[model samples]
Target: MIKNGEEKPTTNPVTAPYRYEISAEQCRSCDRCKKACKAGAIRGERGQAAYLIDEEK
Candidate 1:
């Protein structure tokens, strides 16, 4: 695509990255994953709440 006097390069773009998700009652809440996640996408409620990835983050 071109705009003004510049052209955007679309040779290589993100197609479909991994849609990571954890099923309900799947996470053991071991806190191991929380430590591993650098993006801090993993989130959950208190106690044994099921953890879900915050993709917006």
Candidate 2:
């Protein structure tokens, strides 16, 4: 029911989940990671001991 060059459609597709995390205790609060984050997921005060991460971002 198909031509020689025809291709079959995929019924299911595989996807990789997006993953990111920040270690509050290990973080030096250098603000480097916050600046690099394009999604603005990282939030905290400058020179603070810890930072926060927004998973929904």
Candidate 3:
């Protein structure tokens, strides 16, 4: 209820799971962990990879 003018939602949007970064320097570029990430939060560039909870996730 709003005296001025407002709307309210009953539920919040579902957020994807969080991803923590693994040491890129230690990453072997095998992509094994990347394949294992069900959330598709793992991304790589130039042989160095990182895990992030981006919009794609």
Candidate 4:
């Protein structure tokens, strides 16, 4: 396949059938993880139990 005006390799990358997730009930609302995320893919707020990761990222 062509990408960025360049041809890509014929090899296919491996992908997992499952994804990691943290339940809202399991979340303690700690800001540590959010702070550690440099890509800003993690969406959540401190003091709030709900959290989610952006699949696009």
Candidate 5:
């Protein structure tokens, strides 16, 4: 088969797993962000530094 002025479509390649981070100093630890995350990825005590677990997400 021959094509004239036609090209095939391309797809975006998959990239590395996404990494989430939170600033412990900046975080107020209000628990609002944790509550919003339905995936339960955020873990840590209230009024303390919170960590984001990639596996939990």
Candidate 6:
């Protein structure tokens, strides 16, 4: 039975995946992750790079 305000435990393998947010200071404009990403969800501008969620995915 479940109780109110209780959370269910889950570890399903099919669940959505998450990405680690790299620090901006650490970014040397390497663009390695951008090239690595097949989804093309990364873009660089203004001397800084960021990961964007591509609608295609």
Tens-place lDDT per residue, model 3, 1-57, is: 223335554444556755476774677776776778787877665355544334556
- Candidate 5 regions exceeding 4 Å error are 1-16, 51-56
Better of 5 and 6 by lDDT: 5
User: Which ten residues in a row are the worst by lDDT in model 5?
Assistant: 1-10
Candidate 1 lDDT over 3-57, as tens digits, reads 3435644444556777887766577776667667899998765467777788887
Poorest lDDT segment (10 consecutive residues) of candidate 2: 1-10
On residues 1-57, what C-alpha lDDT tens digit does candidate 4 reach at each position? 324445655543555544557677788878776788777778888887677888666
* Global lDDT scores for all candidate models: 0.71, 0.80, 0.60, 0.71, 0.69, 0.63
lDDT of the structure predicted as candidate 6: 0.63
Residue by residue across 1-57, what tens digits does model 2's lDDT show? 333445855443446767877776688989999999999998998897788888998
Indicate which candidate wins on lDDT: 2
Q: Give the clash count for model 4.
A: 0
TM-score to true structure, per model: 0.57, 0.64, 0.44, 0.56, 0.52, 0.48
Candidate 1 local Cα displacement, residue 49, angstroms = 1.3
User: What's the CA error at residue 5 for candidate 5, in Å?
Assistant: 23
- Candidate 5 achieves a global lDDT of 0.69
| lDDT (10s digit) by residue, model 6, range 1-57 | 343455865455566777656567677767787788787776775355644445545
> Which of candidates 1 and 2 is the stronger one according to TM-score?
2
Flag regions of model 2 displaced more than 4 Å.
Answer: 1-14
Off by over 4 Å in 4: 1-18
- How many pairs of residues collide in model 2? 0
